[model samples]
Target: MTLYPVEAGNFKLDGGAMFGVVPKSLWNRTNPADSNNMIDIAARCLLIEEGDKLILIDTGMGDKQSEKFFSYYYPWGDHSIDKSLKKYGFHRDEITDLFMTHLHFDHCGGSIQWNKDRTGYEPAFKNARFWSNEEHWLWATQPNEREKASFLKENIIPMEQSGKLHFLEREKDEVFSENKELGFGVLFVDGHTDKQMIPHIDYKGKKLVFMADLLPTAGHIPLPYVMGYDTRPLLTLPEKKKFLETAANDNYYLFLEHDAHNEIITLKHTEKGIRLDKTHTFNEIFN
Candidate 1:
């Protein structure tokens, strides 16, 4: 199996919101903020090449949203899904599975795109089966006022309409099938978003976890640093605490989704609690 870091694009988000309850004095060192208080974030997706299946972990925010809509969050960067795929001698059509960690715009937006005429949207990976949990599918479709903005209909409806949408499990307890050789185990996290799936992959004798919003960046290793964007911050603390303990015990490598500087981080148990041991890109660990 081969892994490629597919960087769809970069965007700006409020650093305070990204690191809830964490002070600017602490987070600014990890990621400095611009004049607008927005920090650069990468919509970094993972592409898996395993035999006949080319599975894409998440899609970056697509370029379908209106400029006025995009004004809220500035999306920048030259890297794109196509460019990342091409770098590995692959194409959109080559992807057999689109494994979404969740349906958040940044995670699943690239799953769908504008049609040729631009009148309606269509699945970006025409040949791939878009995977999302049934509970998350329901939650996102009938989103609460707090999360409505994040779960845009344009990015989701296309997958269901195209008949490419498939559910991993209905209940939050059950996740993807466990195939030891596949090296990818799904960890369902609800604090970030409903049933958000974080893939724990066994790579080169190392346990590598795709840290979605549960632990967005290395700076978020602190137990209390949950995101303000989370619907349930209380639930996030325990979730993060449990995950970190396990990661520290297992010596797992965490792959950051939004961290522009640090791609991978290892956590060490500390008196103050868990702390970051080291930081590096995915390639550094894999190569």
Candidate 2:
């Protein structure tokens, strides 16, 4: 099984929002902010190429949103899904599965794009079966006021409308379950958003986890460093605590999704609880 780090896009977000409640004095040390207090963020999606399956996890912010809409998040990079895919000699049309960790605009935004005529939105990857769980599908479609902004209709509905959206069922009380079709286990996390699926893949004899929002960056290794955007920060505490502890114990290589600088990270059990031990590039480890 070959795993590729797909560079979807690069953008910047408010450091305060990224690191909730945590004092700037603390988080700024790891994720330093610019003059506008914005920190660099990457829509670092993952591409899993195993046998006949070509699964792409979390398409980054597509170039469909209006300039005014995108101005809010300072996008500053030439890296794109097309360029990255082409770098690895692939294209969006080749993706068989589009597994989104959640339906947030940044994560799933690239899943849909304006049609040739720009008359309406359509599935960006026409050949792909878009994946989202039943619970998250409902949560995203019928979003609450707090999360409404993140769940955009244009970025979501087109998949279901296109008749290619698929749901992964997680039995009640099942924290981690294997998806035979995707050939990986997804850890169900709700603190960030309802039922955000974190992929746990057994890649080339090493355990690699897609660190969606559960642990956005190596800086978020501490238990108290949850994102402010999370619907329930309290719930994030235990969810992060449990998962991070397990990650540290199991020696899992965390594939960071949103960190612009750090690609992959490993954790260690320190006196201050689980902390980032070392960071690695996808090529250094996976290649």
Instruction: Give the least accurate 10-residue stretch of model 2, judged by summed lDDT.
Output: 278-287
What would the TM-scores of all predictions be?
A: 0.95, 0.99
Best by TM-score: 2
Candidate 1 stretches with Cα past 4 Å from truth are 170-183
- The residue-level lDDT of candidate 1 at 200 comes to 83
Clashing residue pairs for model 1? none
Model 1, 1-287: lDDT tens per residue? 88888898889999999988889998888778999999989888888888888989999888888899779888776889999899889999989999889999988998898999999999888899988878889999999999999999999988999987888753434644453433478888788888888898877788888887888777778888888999889988888888899999989988888887788899899899999998887777889
Candidate 1 TM-score versus the reference: 0.95
Against the reference, the lDDT scores of all candidates come to 0.86, 0.93
lDDT score at residue 142, model 2, on the 0-100 scale: 98
lDDT per residue for candidate 2 within 151-172, as digits (tens), equals 9999988989999989998778
The candidate 1 region of ten consecutive residues with least summed lDDT is: 170-179
